[model samples]
Target chain A: MEPDVLLSVRDLRIAFDGVEAVRGVSFDVRPREVLAVVGESGAGKSLTARALLGMVPAGATTGGTIRPDLSDRRGRRIALVPQDALSALSPVHPVGDQLAAAVRSVARVSRKEARARAVAALERVGIPDAARKARAYPHEYSGGMRQRAVIAMATVNEPDIVVADEPTTALDEEHRDQVLRVLGERREAVGAALVLVTHDMDVVREHADRMLVMYAGRLTELGPADEVLARPRAPYTAGLLASLPEHAPRRRRLPALPGTPPAPGALPPGCAFAPRCSLAADACHATEPEPQQVAGRLVACHRWADTPDLLQEAYRASS
Target chain B: MPLLDVRDLVVRYGTVTAVDRVSFSLEAGETLALNGPSGCGKSSTALAVLQLRRPDGGEVHFEGQELTSLTDRELRPLRPRMQPVFQDPYGSLNPRHRIRDAVAEPLRVQGRRPTPGEVAELLDRVGLDPSYGDRRPHELSGGQCQRAGIARALASGPRLLVLDEPVSALDPSVRAGVLNLLADLQDDLGLGYLFICHDRAVVRHFADRVVEMREGRVISGWRRP
Candidate 1:
């Protein structure tokens, strides 16, 4: 493992009912960096993030290894901000009490001190009148305020890494940006790295320092966010980018990638994405391509060299 | 005449005013989008236009006839001309019923028994396989379920579709496919669409005219040249 790396994941595989959902995925989280995991539904991005905290659903089997074993140090060294703020919080208790309880669980502190820390955490996340708001239950707080309270709870223990899974999927654009900004600021203040799992490309472009694109439970591309967005090296990544209404030219129809992702149990013989890739060839269907160095990134495609030209041709043909 | 028109629409819940004097119009074969943040009364306006919720004050004119002045019995015949497609596909559909039955429901409500072949045709028209008609809503993917919803909406032979966040829940790739299907349907049927969406990029690409809303009022609007 590199000395600067905070966590190293190697050949991680998660399966259920004798079928693999995440097949041999590997990546690293560097210190204090934001790493965004981008993929569509059933692509196993959420399962991968849950595996980091040893929180995969029951009946699922996990393989391979995660260095440092941060699962045991969940609250103190690693924390999770789930999608539904209400579920993460208990409706019966006051918001401040829950956060204070979280602090007291990890550290030996008086109730007064824990309560004080909780209020400060809420204040740090831009919660107005933190002391007064602390007494309110989860249901009493508004949607945006509840999200901020969850962020405060996650950062109260000052974990080394925070894994947020689709934290703003239910929010509109205005509230989504506000939540992301608060999450970013809180993580930076606590000096913790963030592993954000989201399908929104705009969120990745704005918040991520690095990005990992997943397709059919496998790594398709991993590189610096800006570089990958500017010039994608994998066909799947390029297709996903082109499908965004904001990225494509002003037209009636977008260049959508045809076909849906193969189900986990019914995956194709070779590369899982071959059925949908416009750049697929005989070699692509014959064997799954391994990730290799290509243009300052690691791309898993048999025809990485031809991706740029082929993509341009495909766009022109469609238009 | 415009396909649909509203003047000074108003909706209230108890003492709170949700849609305060909002107005917009749509022509056949065109898309008019209602874009705004949450709690901006976009959904209220849609419900009012559909007459699912009677507006407290306004004139809703559809096909040169005023809808607000009509009674329940009078509106019954006109209801088939306008339909709604909601956000959550699974929630919008009856989980226990098969897709074929769901698609046939609109015709059944109008005192007609649709043939199975007609149901299959509706399924095929929305880009779904005819075999999908046999399966329940849960058996289909999110995008497929949404397509099934659209098929049901089309069964009514509606001239206008009130699409409330129709593709917001699907993946990006699947959303594009659904959007394209909607475009083709509009062109073929000459149907007007009242699209309600929050994503600015999608609204820009899909709507022929956009009415921006804030706090239940139209803040701005634009149309393609």
Candidate 2:
């Protein structure tokens, strides 16, 4: 393991009923870095994130290895900020009590000390009147406030890493930005790295230090956020970026990616994205591409060299 | 005259006013987006425009006919011309029903059996294969189910569509396909669209005009140059 890397995932594979959902995958989480895992709904990004915490669904089989075995020290060394804030919290208990309980569970602390830490965590996340709000149940808190509370809970233990799975997907634009800002601020305050799993490209562009683009449970691209956004080497990455409304010119029709992602266990031969790739060739159909160094990034596409040129041509033709 | 016009719409749930004197108009083959945050009355305005919920105070005119004053029976005929496609595709559709029967429901509600292949044609029109008609809503993916919902909406032969965050629940790739289908549908059928969406980028791309709302009121509005 690299000394700078906080954790390393090697050939991580997850299966359900003998059907592989996450194929061989590898990545490293550097200290205090934001690593975003992005893909479509059934892309197994969420499954991969959950597997880090040893929280895969029941009856599912997992393979490969995650270094340091952080699962044993869940709250103290690693924590999860789930998608739904309401589900993460107990409706019956006051939000503060939950946070305090979380603190007490991982550490041997007095009730008074734990309660104070809970209030402080709430304050850190910018919940107004933290002490008073602590006594209120989950329902009493508004949606945004509840989300902030969840962030607070995730960071209260001062974990080394936080895995947030589409934390702001349910929120509208204003609330979404606010929640991300709070999450970012809290993670910075705790000096914890974040593994953000989201499908929103804009969020990835704005918040991630590095991005892992997934396609049909396989890595298609992995690189620094700015470089990947600026010059994508993978055809799948190019297509996904081109289809975004914000990135495209305001037109009647967007240049959408041609087809839906194939379901797990029903993947196509060779590369999973070849069927939808405009630049796909016979070699792409015959053999799957392995991640190779290309322009400071790792791209799993045989036609990585020609992706940019083809992308420009496609854009010109569309415009 | 515009295809649809709403004037001084007001909806109150007990002490809370959801839609306060909100007004907008739409034209045939044009898209007017209602853009705002959640709880800002965007959906309430849509419900009022569709007459799905009778506004406490307002005048909704469709094809120059006032809809608020019409009884449920009186509005039945006009309802077919203006259809709603909700955000949740799976929830809007009956899980137990096949896609074919769901699409045929509008005609059946009017006491007319759909002509042979009409349901299949509707499904195909939305870019879904006609064979999808044999499957239920749960048997399809989110994007596929949403397409089925759109097919059902088209079965009524609507001149106006109230699309309330139709693509928000879908993935980006799937959303783009659905949005393109909507644009093509409008071009081919001259359908008027009252689009309600919170995504500004999508609203900018899809709508001809935009009505920005906040705190139950129309804060501002603009049109594409």
Candidate 3:
């Protein structure tokens, strides 16, 4: 029955002191699925990912039941491939030893076995001279190589879920492609769920099966990656999709949603996006918009159902 | 005139050559993007141009002056002419310092006392509210903090802005805002930009010319559409 969702998080909320950073956010990630969490800075996508792994930073505190369905797996519930590769990799430790240590730390594996597995993982990620490169410190490896090293560590344990939080953010396009290719291959080796939290629509479109849109501290929309992108419902989601440079209208003023995103501490009571949302009404300001089924997508907006294909029409009509 | 010119630029950290024979020029009022994989020396090249890091060899001519040979005291006057906006805004600015002080530092460093009126104008240009001036780095969002960094870069009236992975650290959505702001600022002030990044999409969309680097070398020269 639908392979029993690997991680089912509901009504998740994270806060810094009393101010909400992730307010009543929820989503499900299935086995062998890459659910892309797409949002702008301060949209709470990272906080949500951190919540799942129980790895929020010192100042942040969370409220959520991250019930990982790892009964069928042999390793940790989650492994994180952080955005900064150089900082993520220990400068003093050799890349190979670090990766091998990760695999062994997850469970019971002989040091020799883990080292061999580390080499295999490195090879799988397309690192040339895997065995030799393993002994090199972080300073010796290039940016792209270091990123691959991090990915190899995360997947070496064959964890149930991998939280790739902006894993390709620092690398150039070519290196980004290489890292993504490695992650795709690793998914085949270990039937793990991947939650790729990023802001790049191109990345989510290329690699993810499903997508969740976040604004301020709450979820705005959720649906298939392509489907939601093709027909975004929430006004904030529509605005973000339209604002991507590739999707912009030539020689025309961009369809910019005016007003800066609200500070997490000073967010409006009902809808966090009401300030910049053109379609926002009084109802949006009076009460919170719970997730409602609109055109087979879960959208958290009061008037989204009525605006069927409005975003698509707007994008099409722009040019 | 090229706002900034570089030829055979090389920077070394002990025995390791971080940048090797890197050369590209940002034309006056034109954007030139430098794209390459990490450790390709894009950021190092930018820093050396600012003389934040002295190059072991090469020429960095800004506004028709060779910056490489200038001493710290000699370079003081030219420092405001080419300012750097770092990849990480968090690391670039002091955490305890208010946004106003951070943005105003360049002006203050140049021996000009910054008034609230001038700081407000700077904030307005970068799309940050003047109200945010009192807040520290921790109070600002990644995008906002970055815009504040840009304000700092612009405060001293630099003719050429060297943005080293400026928006790469920002979210995709916030990137558009920063880019559009840069474009608008360029149009208004006719300021030249050396947009150093790895994302070809960003380079293609924002820059007038493209330069690619590989292993600290300029593998491809400038190309314009």
> How would you encode candidate 2's per-residue C-alpha lDDT over A24-64 as one tens digit per residue?
88998887688999989888899999888888899999899
Quantify all predictions' global Cα lDDT against the true fold. 0.89, 0.88, 0.82
iRMSD, per candidate, in listed order: 1.4, 1.4, 2.8
**Model 1 CA lDDT for position A51:** 90
lDDT of 1 by residue, B1-225 (tens): 899998999999999888999888899999999999877899999999999999999889999999888999999999889999999999999999999999999999999999988999999999999999889999898899999999999998999999999999999888888888998999899999999998898988888999999888999999988
Give the per-residue lDDT of model 1 (tens digit) for A234-291.
9888888877787555544777778888889998878899999877899988999999
- Taking chain A by itself, what TM-score does each prediction score? 0.94, 0.94, 0.93
Error of 3 at B169 (Å): 3.0
List DockQ for all candidates: 0.69, 0.70, 0.35
Candidate 1 ranges with C-alpha deviation above 4 Å? A1-3, A309-319
- TM-score, cand. 1 vs. native: 0.95
Residues A1-319, candidate 3: write the lDDT tens digits: 4466878988898888888889998788888888999887788898888677777778877686767634344335578888888888889899899888888777688999989999998887888999999888889987778888888888887777888999977776776777787777656766677889987777888888899998888889999998888878787887877766666543233455566677789878788888777777899898889988887878999878554454565567665
Regions more than 4 Å wrong, model 3: A1-4, A15-20, A53-78, A84-111, A135-140, A249-254, A263-265, A305-319, B69-74, B94-104, B113-116, B129-139
Tens digit per residue, CA lDDT, model 2, B148-217:
9898899888999999999999988888888888989999999999999998889988889999999899
lDDT, candidate 1, at A216? 89
